[model samples]
Target: MLELEKVTAAYSGSKVLFGVDITANKGEITCLVGRNGVGKSTTMKAIMGLVSTPSGDIKLDGKSIFTLPTYSRAKAGIGYVPQGREIFPQLTVKENILLGMEANPGVKEIPQEIFETFPILKEFLERRGGDLSGGQQQQLAIARAVVSKPKVLILDEPTEGIQPSVIQEIGRVITRLKKDMAILMVEQYLEFVLEVSDRCYVMEKGRISMSGRTDELDKDRLQQLLSM
Candidate 1:
């Protein structure tokens, strides 16, 4: 589980998140959705310690992790799949996945579940990451993150640039993964978010403006917010 309380973050002295508060509970998917430049990605960055949070607290399982470095946060059970999918282009697929285990040094091999979640990865183990299609690369990114068995998985725009069929597969994978770990995602695709998320938070200008069970939120209103 992850919680951000009154989290105000900035990049180079310009604040982006303003008094943001959100929570991701174990065994559920929590989504943060909003238009561009509204600090959705910054919220994820703040949680990962990739951005500076001058004031506020980030907690994992009730303990504060605001002071932990990015690596420490990953080691502390946060597996992040950044917005761009950021996989190493030159590394072999297996090598890219193996990098995820840097946080869990004791794990000797890629867990079987990773292959189970993504059978395509098994066939592409020796292939260069850059050689894969965008969807395959996205699956590779998710595989790398989940291989570490993170308690809270942060996925930023998992559907971005992915094909429709791949998006459906990713949705299924996300639904399956939520049975084990807390899932927090930043997504602009409303249909995908509604299909997979248990709860939703609508952010506007760096603050959470609306939040509720996914089915309970006003779909038309959400569409309006995203359009603005």
Candidate 2:
């Protein structure tokens, strides 16, 4: 399991997260949901070591990773697919996927499983990443992350600006990926959250205000929390 215990983070002099607590277990799909500027993405950055957490601990399995740098954290099995699908625009789809291998030493080639899961990638291996549509780029981003064979995958707002049909495909891909590793995603779309998340944590003003199994949350109550 990957866990953040009372994690507090700041940017320059402004605090964004306050004693935030959440966990993502292997084989489960956990989601961090909240409105804009509520610190969902900040929480993801904190886990990935892109931001400093001066007052809390981040653990992978049972070990503390608070002091590890971003590259070290990736070596520790934390794969991050940041928002906006930050693929190398000038690189081919195949090259972009290969870039993830830098995190995992001794990995020589893209895994056959990745191609099996995202067949479209096989068809467009030579295409530049920037040439693909938003949905295709999203798939390539995910494929890049999983190719590193991390124990946990952190995705930030993956469905944003994606088409409905592509959203469905990404949802299916996430479901399948959860069987082997933990998936901790920050998402804004409520319907997608309700469908894909096994557990949900609702963040408000830099803190977690509500969390529970997806089936346990009453839709009306959830709607109210999200709207607040």
Candidate 3:
């Protein structure tokens, strides 16, 4: 499990997350929902150690990792797909995915699992990342992240601004990914979050205002806070 205990993070002394606590269990999907800038992305950053949370402890499977740098944290089994799909625009899809394994040389050859899950990527192995549609680029970004097979996978708004059909395909892929990895997703799409997540956290102003299993949250409460 990936756990953050009373984590607090800041950018140049300006606070974003205030004593945030969250857990993403192995083989489960944990969803975080909030309006833009309520610290959903900040929470993801804290967990990934992209931003320092000096005051709180971050643990992976019960050991502390608060001191680890971002890349080192990836070495210890964490992968992040940032808000924008940060694939190399000039590189072919196959090359972009291959870069994910730079740290582990013995781990070679793009796994068949990744290609099967995102078959379109296989078809476009020779295409440049910038040439694909936004949704297709998003898929490539995810495929690249999984090449090293990290235990914890994070995605920040994977479906933002995509067409409905592509969104559904992405959702299905997320479901399949959970079978082998822990997932923490931050999204604005309410119905999609409810459909696939095992549990949800409602964030307002950097704190979890309410959280529970997807089935336990009331419609009225979710609508009111999300509309704020």
Best by TM-score: 1
Ranking, lDDT, top scorer first: 1, 2, 3
Clash count, one per candidate: 0, 0, 0
Residue by residue across 111-165, what tens digits does model 1's lDDT show? 9888888999999999999999999999999999988888999999999999999
- Model 1 bad stretches (over 4 Å): none
Lowest summed-lDDT stretch of 10 residues in model 2?
219-228
| TM-score of each predicted structure versus truth | 0.98, 0.97, 0.96
> How does model 1 score by TM-score?
0.98
True-structure lDDT of candidate 1: 0.94
lDDT by residue (1-228, candidate 3, tens digit) is 788899999988888999988999888899999988899999988988877686888898888878988878877777788888888999999899988876356677888988888899999999998899999998888888878888888899999878899889989988888988889999999999989899899999989999998888896889888985
lDDT of 2: 0.92
The residue pairs that clash in candidate 3, if any, are: none
- Angstrom error of the Cα, residue 96, model 3: value is 1.2
> Candidate 1: which pairs clash?
none
Q: Cα lDDT for residue 29, model 2?
A: 96
